[model samples]
Target: MPIHGNKMKKVFCYSLIFGILQLIPIRALGWGFKAHRQLNYAAVFTLPPELFKFYKPHINYITEKAVNADKRRYAFADEACRHFLDADHYEKKVPIDTIPNAWNNAVLKYSEDTLLAYGIVPWHLQRVQYQLTKAFAEKNLYLILKLSADLGHYAADLHVPLHSTENYNGQLTEQEGIHSLWESRLYELFEPNYDFFTGRASYLPNVSETIWERFAQSFAALDSVLIFEKLAGLKHPNKYSLQSNGRTNVKVYNEAFCIYYNHLLNGMIERRARASINLIGSLWYTAWVDAGQPDLSNLKEEPLKTENNDETLIQTLFQNSRIIGRKED
Candidate 1:
């Protein structure tokens, strides 16, 4: 939790980091994205093939909703929790304690939103699992896919630093590129090393503290992203230059960008990697738990039962999954 001044409380915010337009590689100013798709892809490979009996269907569900993020359907759907999700919900000028009951209600509402957005993954899984057991309810394909979509979106959101920040994409501070740097460029450079494979699920402990920690890390990183970039840009404006490779000329990632990013990001890469891996694993496990621990088999066959039925199911799942698309804050 932010150290609330005893005086009065005013601001509460969540980062909106996902919708950036471009990925700029200015050396160490952002993640080198050395890992790219490696870790997540590896996690998929590690899943027990037999689980594909279930996994394949979920993948199909998410794929179908892949465009929803762009369409802002999720954002609209998530508007229900806007108080907690929006960085603007809290006060910038005053203390939190000074706020009236109206603000308190806003904070409470926000708390619920935060819970749903960040922690809904496991719950979604659990719900599906329950339905699956209570009379072969797997046929509720729409519910399955829709809820899965929400989870995918939330998971992706968690990886984004700006998603956890009050300023989010930096619209609040005029530091817009910070969103892309945290998600896109970082994924582009260091994603390969992220250990998406965390084995099977485990019991979930109380996640309140965990979520708060995530917010803190992202909020903290925003300073470095903005400050270092500005400081570096001042001293070495052109220190970053792009180079042409055969296929496409990549930004040669300037020294200033690297130096500044490293200065700000520091251990965030490793911290994020560990969190990402465990989070994925935890979500999967929670889903299984929520699913009432149904045996991988014995569940009914695909609803449509087409040869490509798996494809359809896979397209239906979401909140977080493979970077089939753009980065989140």
Candidate 2:
């Protein structure tokens, strides 16, 4: 069968659009990469003199590699689950007290499969904190830096309201793309004025309890995150505008709509970002303290080699199965 001119043009256009969409990175899930780097960079100053002196020398690495966890989602099949926890998946109304704070207990009650099926951010955070503490104890400079960067990424993720819910991207509420609009787009526009000066980091006696508390706070805010966005959409029916990404035109929330949305939220993004900064710094400091306050100032800075074999294997498995934990995209 021979195709007509209009049909041929339609086919070509659709192919071009799909190609452009493929160029868009799949790692745009959690806090935007830009925001993650900024958060990690600002968190360094919150450390005490002992830790700050050591971290200051390689602050660039800490900031730049903060998005490694997000990048790993493509290569590691289980990595996606560490970025979020769909609290509502557990029960109606999301009773924080009913959910076990400890991983072992939660796994016992809900089964590991069930827990991972939704997400395991809060529990995984404690695991990373332990790894960081062990790295500090061993004074393994490479692991310390790598684990610190990973820790910061997860800590920031925990503060996002969408990360605590099943409808993370608002796909369930007919407001798809709200995840990026709330965390990424708004920060791109208004981050310049956000106050990142979260005082000095503090020690955490119990990491598990502290993380669960943070989870609860984020879950509590999920309602407003959804409702206000709905209200904003009702107010501005023409909320999106076409913008070029150097390759093709894409729909994005307009600046005016973003400004209006931010107004409705009343600095909620700024507050959460500040809290993330504080939590990252505090977790780093706490890990150091728990490791008996290691003298990091004298550790040798050894260049770490990049290892991608495991990542390659995991990526192969992911492609074969085409299954992943909850994700924004």
Candidate 3:
């Protein structure tokens, strides 16, 4: 049967709409997989020759596996709290110092349930830093790589403003989907123009204090993140458009609107991304130094004995504890 005129025109129109919809991205959590990989990839270059030599070869593993923590969120109930901390939920506008730096102290003061309910990123990161340091001390190639990749994910998460807020996805402000719009969409669009050269990594005098400081910086930027999105919405009336995801139509920020929002943000996304890169590098270097600067050039490349399954990794990392908290996407 030969279709012509109106029938052909209708088929072409429907095809075009579907094609365009495929081009738009669905919402993602925590900087998206692309940005996370890029951050881990860039951080490797910031290492000194001593550390770089060892990391250079396994850089791909680190980069590709940087999203493991994010993946663990879906498999393990306990993994979600490790990626973010809703500080405002604890005490709005309080100094970061008010929260205990040590996990034991935090558990004592806030109770384990309370800490888990809000989030435990800063605390969990410190624990992982110690684990990395121990891995370095023992010269365990497998644990070193595994812990390093996980560290990069959590450290990068701390740099996101939404990760530090109660209104992480902007459901509170009626700016839903702003999480992915800022961290994932903008980076996917403008990352080519970003400057990733953050110089060499440095040793932190105090790891715990430094982690708290980074969280504070991210929290301080939360207001700007929310406020500017609203401003961008007001400036661009057609802020959102419906796109099909093969399942159903969902609202997403318009491309032009994303550009306008990025412009209003004044390079904030890039700065934070660079910050994440630098922080990841610094933490890796710091852990190695704290572990007595092991000679990695001669360490044996032993494959990790674990099954490489999500559940296996989660059990190994978290011990399958029951996590009680609000899992913020």
Candidate 4:
């Protein structure tokens, strides 16, 4: 929880000018906080008994903290960019296949600022996998649990169709706010009836390829996400509309319209949610296996990490700052 000199400076500045950046009322709507928590909670059941035993004791922590990455967006200037990747943003000049899987290579080609400007979710997911592997090998309970929760969140983000597109919220296409409508509103409304029993975790032979493939699939689905919403709007018109609040002000959406839209999408939201649940477990198990299958039995009896006041300060600033919507999704 310790912030380095520069990050500390950023945090200090955030405290001074809290809620100064309110250009848009929208927040970066990931898979929604509840789905994230549920996905992480379900992922624990997928772990092998040996690993599951350690995680089972801390399942609540994992589930609750799954949105820490999203929360961090309020505290860190660079944090927002890590939650999404506008893959089609680069497709105009850069072929999707040509983007490097490695961080250093991507930086060399596109420059660090440019990549961060777009997103580094896939590359960052790759980086966290290594960190989780190292943490597991060393039996660092706190680090392992922390990385596991974060990895689950990032993997879920990658599966979101909006997170993979330049027109994430349909802002460019006059479908503004569609990002939250698809990712947050629909799922939150209807997810109770959806299934969560996605089977056991398995080891991934190549994490990079799998991560890239997920974003590729998400990118391909972007059109359907937009097209269906527009068609549903035409068919349903004002029937499903309702009003709500944004981070700073009022907002609106149609529940019945969303339900009908969800129906037209043919279970896409459920499929993505299910895939996230399955992939999260697989990634966690894969990291553990690659780390030589460390014994977690002893660590379960021990406390993971001690309290840190720096984290408390950062959290205070996060609450004070009303910043939202740095990246589209």
Candidate 5:
């Protein structure tokens, strides 16, 4: 059963194109890649003097690696789940008290498959916090920097309203692809005016509760995110136009429509970005404090050799299972 060379070549070419397309940042979810990196970079400045010296020197690494988790989604089976929690998918729905904040307890209530089937962001975030704490305890420069960038990413994702809903991209509500539009397109257009000077990072007394509360707030705001977009569309019909987004010219909501939408939502993107900055810094501070506030002045930098390493891993991860939960993309 040997395949012909041409057929094999065609398959390989098609597969390569598909993988490249996935990484092209056309329209996925969760703040897009650029915004995540910017948030991580800014969060470094928010760290106190105690951890600033160590993190500031490696700010570029932290910033670039901030999207590591997003890239990992293609490779790691559970990586996508870590980015979001569609709490509404569970029977109890949002503000769900039935599922424990703890991993084992939650697994007991709803089997491991079930928990993974509906998203496990809060638990995954807690796990990452613990990892960061461990890294701080050991003073492992590599692990500390790696986990800090990673933890910041997950914390930021939790603040995204679309990430917390089953209808993440608004496909279910007939507002399909609204996830990228709200979180990505808006920020790409209006982030220059955002207030990123969100003060110093404070200690979070209860990390799990804080994360859960953030998700709850995000889910609560999901309705407005959708409704306002619908309203804006009605008010400004035929406002979309083809615009050059990188190498492609795609249809996008025009500047006027986007401004109208942003006004209608009372600056949701700015608020969420600010919230992400604060939360990322606070969580990093919390992990460091919980680990005895280790002095990292002497920590050395360990930059990743290949930025495209995750892409290779993603190609493999995608080959295994592209569908994690309710939505395929």
Candidate 6:
């Protein structure tokens, strides 16, 4: 497998973990979940499907005080890691004077670390999913917005390559801020023109494959992201910038960054966005299927399952954390 192929695997693992984390209760889980980006319910605007069948007309009817409309207010406790790969110990493994691409030949040197990062992601997602479902069952209802947020979080994670690795930011390669540079910065800058032609319906039979495939494609770009980012840093009109709020004086982006970066991504940005939109929709569809096809028309049942399930996930994690804490003590 290519070096980035390994990293892509890590990103897939994170999605599964995020799904698990959604299982926790809102109170226990806290507001950290918002760190994950919200999914667009606008997808439903394009097609009226199962859940929105009867409720279709009122789909946009602002439900009064049911679910929080502003998702950005809530942040997933574990989500901060999504913006950048955790490489605190790299200073020990790497020399202080090192730049990102310095280790062109060192990709495999940290293979184990890369694999470990990928492994942690899924558990977190699943934990959250458990909580969200239970929470919805409690009120005997599911909030489309909240559910979309959770679903989107996992779906988005699937699309991020660095989420799949220890070198998420390309720190090993000196691409220190590549994670946010690509996921956050690049998207924020180019999202307006991003392609919406993801097409109709999905083809994946298994959820795992869906996750890995998306992640692998993302990971495949790691090299280009890392190497090209460096090139961008060196090429832009004194501003081929990155994760840093673009307004900064970082000359990391220019015609060069655009050229090489796009080449590296192989024109996957718009496609990836489309995939993200569709994946969230598909996941929502699948979740309903797993719930035995809940009647989303009846507001009384949907959000209840979402919230109540979320509460349960929170409780489980607390219990686990307590156990681990006591052991450590």
Among these predicted structures, which one has the highest lDDT?
Answer: 2
lDDT-sorted candidate list, best first: 2, 3, 4, 5, 6, 1
Number of residue pairs clashing in candidate 3, backbone atoms closer than 3 angstroms, sequence gap of 3 or more or interchain: 0
TM-score of each: 0.54, 0.87, 0.84, 0.85, 0.86, 0.55
The alpha-carbon deviation from the true structure for residue 136 of candidate 4, after best TM-score superposition, in angstroms, is 0.4
Tens-digit lDDT track for model 5 on 1-329?
77689778757754674456444433234787779999999898888887787788789889988877875665555666777777777733456676688799889888998877778888889999999999999998888878998998988888898877778877777887687778777889889989998899999999989988888888888889989989999999876899885788988778888889999999888888988998999999999999998888776655654435654765675564343334434
Among these predicted structures, which one has the highest TM-score? 2
The alpha-carbon RMSD values of the candidates against the true structure, listed in the order shown, are 13.8, 8.3, 8.8, 6.4, 6.6, 14.3
Candidate 6: how many backbone clashes?
97
1-329 in candidate 4: lDDT tens per residue? Answer: 89999779867765453334333344454787778999899888887787788889789889977977876675667678888887876784223677888788889989998898888789888889999999999998889888998999999998898887777778889888788788878888889988998888889999999888887878778888999999998988874444544434344576678778998999999999888888999999999999999878777545545235336645655575644436443
Candidate 2: misplaced stretches above 4 Å? 1-28, 307-329
Worst 10 residues of 5 by lDDT: 320-329
Q: What is the C-alpha lDDT profile of model 2 across 40-64, one tens digit per residue?
A: 9999999989889989988998997
For candidate 2, the per-residue lDDT at 242 reads 98
Which lDDT tens digits does candidate 1 get at residues 198-245? 565444564433444454454445456667656656766665477665
Task: Using TM-score as the measure, name the better of candidate 2 and candidate 3.
Answer: 2
The 10-residue segment with the lowest total lDDT in model 4: 17-26
- Backbone-clash count (model 4): 1
Better of 1 and 3 by TM-score: 3
Better of 2 and 4 by lDDT: 2
Question: Whole-model Cα lDDT per candidate?
Answer: 0.42, 0.84, 0.82, 0.80, 0.79, 0.45
Model 3 pairs in collision = none
Which scores better on lDDT, 2 or 6? 2
Please list the residue runs of candidate 4 whose C-alpha ends up more than 4 Å from where it truly belongs after superposition.
1-27, 92-95, 243-251, 300-320, 324-329
lDDT of 6: 0.45
Candidate 2 yields a Cα-based lDDT of: 0.84
